[model samples]
Target chain A: MAFEVKDVLIVLPAFNEQASIVHTLNDIDKNVPGANKLVVDDGSTDKTADYARQAGAQVAQLPFNIGVGGAMRFGFRHASRNGYKVVIQLDADGQHDPAYIPELLRNLDQSDLVIGARFAGEGDYEVHGPRKWAMGLLSTVISRSANSKLTDTTSGFRASGPRAIELFAKDYPAEYLGDTVESLVIALKSGLTVSQVPVAMRKRIGGQPSQNAWQSAVFLFRAATALIIAYMRPTDPANEPHGEKS
Target chain B: MTYFIGPILSIALIAIIVTQLMRKRLRERHALWWAIGAITTLFLSIFPGILLNLSSWLGFVAPLNLVLILGLALMLLVNLQHSAELTDLENKVRTLAEEIAELKLEDSIGKVNVSDFPESN
Candidate 1:
């Protein structure tokens, strides 16, 4: 079926997800037919690029592991440069469902960013203890920055309009936890309209999940620091098409 | 006269800096600044009268005290300068890396056809 959004690219950013790369690509192909799919293999030590290529998705092999921020930036650059009108990012570990791509694209008409939030009162997103507290704190901070309530600030499943594509293609955050926190901060601060929709997410069917509890705390601290910098530092006024909302 | 202490400390420090420079561990650009620092300290230590006159002009208590204070301040300035340069270089390197990574991705994924690029239209 031909999509209403003609120039839409499904971007799957993967790193060492050899076990589920093919499966992820298959889901995109089955769900979103006639869509240009690009798998950004972020310097995976395994044969992720080869598997993704065999699975019939265009493969962009990074020279080294540049983290999710770098990989996503690469995908965005490819989409922006290629004249793709919209880009929907999906995680490679089968955790992100491809069914919500249409909803995200449709919402892109009004907002520059449409996030597929798992905890948007639609599904069960379980967390406990300090991690839950951290998520709540992050959600509050991101909501204020975005000028809209965002339940899942860390959700990788999101879509971007031309303005966001242009911004990210030029410069995106490349830090430990900068992908989600710093990128959102830039989008909101640059006066881009940001919104979220409820979407159910799946548990990782395969592949190793990076980050331990200790590492997660460190990442939280780093992401929080990046958020502060994004707020404090003055961005180029000309780059921001929509004037500062705050 | 604070003679033995000054020469001994500065000489040891200068010796290490020079050795590092010779070994290519320190770049010529940074070596020049360290060399200047070493010479300034050595000159001030050897000539107490010069420091005495300089301190009197600056309204410091004594040349012996001024030498330490001035040297410390100069070193701090040098460190600050190095830090600024390092930060500039780091930013440049990071930008270059991201660009290279983007270009490499384009190459491996699909070489962008300039004619197909939307900007041309």
Candidate 2:
């Protein structure tokens, strides 16, 4: 499967990342030039949209701060409408290397969605405390659901082929932890295949990690709720009327 | 005092619901639930013996306990309904926002194309 850059859209769901939005765009241009790029501004109060537009990528400014899940859903809808066959979701903070984009896209030949797994023996990215435990628990459960061993289920760096793209364009969850953990469960339940490739995590160019020690302590409860709800949700997303007008 | 407070509370609830309906602040669909609840409360307050007999028949030791549990159950149902409605509204809003952004991008791209091609009128 020869995947062309022209058939892919790099979706950067950014929220107030004015400092590094330009650098992220430049990195994509340098690494994957001619690939379609979209920056969902995610209701940034900063100049993230302006920077992205100036960097020559298409910009979609959401009317409110709808979080990463909502922003990525917007990207999927745009891709679905615009005839893009693949979408690569990269972090706006530059922690995800654009260089691994090809490797992710290549794995899409075998699976509907390919996750850029950090802990899959590729990156030195380390997490401790309750956060690591939560990630391990989530990955163990979700891996079982997917019927495949998955090391890092919470990594935002991922690529979606056409099947996953179409499903996500309509049924992507926009809740807390929905974008990563819940999303994989939905994909697996929807009969879409998921695979992962090892990628080294880079230091974020700017902004702060949203998680703190207090939040990590609360992560276990939230992760469990999200996973349970994801599994309990109707497998046929169309039944829920996610795309129903009015 | 208990009878007086019951009637007063039910009346206040009904009054607020009515006011909201009149002001167009609450939809008829939503007000319907509260109206039924307030009317039931009013009826029970006026005829306290009915509740006393019903509670005993329903295997409750005290009428007040029955009232408290019923109220709590009603509140939980209402809260659950509100959450369902809210999730629906959020989904709708997200779809609309995405649509608007996509349209704007298309419009801008169209404008850029027209300018780039000077010969195209």
Candidate 3:
């Protein structure tokens, strides 16, 4: 039962990323040849969908912007329906290198979810101020919840197997900070095994970084709130370990 | 003269409610509660002795305090219901948006409106 590259779906959630959409698609093709590529256009005003279609990736255009959480939920449902065994979420800004797709998928053999973590000694990526503090605290708290040490809980680059895919497609949170921060909590709480691999992050090929200094400061508060809510959520039957449906 | 103000205000509220209902600006389900409240207030205002007796029975030292409390409680209930409805709508909208994207992807084959199918490499 060997897994083929074609069985993996690489999902890129792009928001007004017309500048780098084509380049990112080509990079994925070059790195993971024959792998299926899907670009969920989050109501980009620019020509992101057009460019992605031109570059040979399936484009799912959302009618309006619903953030990355909404776009990724659509992606998971697409993968689940289309029979993709593995899903790797990569950023459209080209910050995530496609070279690590194989490494992530390889880890999926043993674990249900694999995260391409930035702070795990692979790259010299650094954060400062409130953002750094928030990341550190989140890693500590979530690592305890998952019963394993996770150095990067907020990394967007991750791979999900069939179990994680089924759960996420059914109940992925669509709130602010829900995609990255809350998704990890949901996966771990649902009795899925989670692991991380170190990967170097690159500068965006185009478009501005979404966060500012003020946002980073506010991120500390928002991230904490999101975590509290995730923890306090009534345990859903779907979130329980498989076959324990109540 | 001042004692008549309460009855006049209650009558104005009832008139406004009826006008809104006739114009279809408010759903009957929502206006039902407001209409009942207005009519009750009108009855109590026209017969102050009834309000006085009820407030005394309810152990209120002043009838005005009872009026204020009832008004506050009604507003709180309305606000709470609105918040719940808003959350429900948000969830529905998210699901619809996702379904729309899914259907568009399905309808994309042989359609020129969406992105062209990438040529087989």
DockQ winner, 1 or 2: 2
Q: Write the per-residue lDDT of candidate 1 for residues A2-97, one digit (tens) a residue.
A: 225568888888888889989988988788777888888777899888898899888877667767887788778888878987888999999988
What residue runs in model 2 are displaced by over 4 Å at the alpha carbon?
Answer: A237-246, B1-19, B59-61, B111-121
Give the lDDT of residue A181 in candidate 1: 70
How many collisions between residues are there in candidate 1?
0
Off by over 4 Å in 3: A210-213, A242-246, B14-25, B28-40, B43-73, B110-121
Residue-level lDDT of model 3, residues B10-119, one tens digit each, is: 99999999999999998887787788889988998999999899999999999999989988888787788778878889888988999989878877854444445465
Clashing pairs in 2: none
| Number of the candidate with higher DockQ, 2 or 3 | 3
Q: After superposition, how far is residue A202 of candidate 2 from its true place, in Å?
A: 0.7
All models, DockQ values?
0.33, 0.62, 0.78
How well is each residue in A104-147 modelled by candidate 2, as lDDT tens digits? Answer: 98899999999999998987888888888899999999888788
Residue range with the least summed lDDT across 10 consecutive positions in model 2 chain A: A237-246
| Deviation (Å) of A214 in candidate 2 | 2.7
Q: How much does candidate 3 score in TM-score? A: 0.87
Q: Candidate 1 local accuracy as lDDT?
A: 0.79
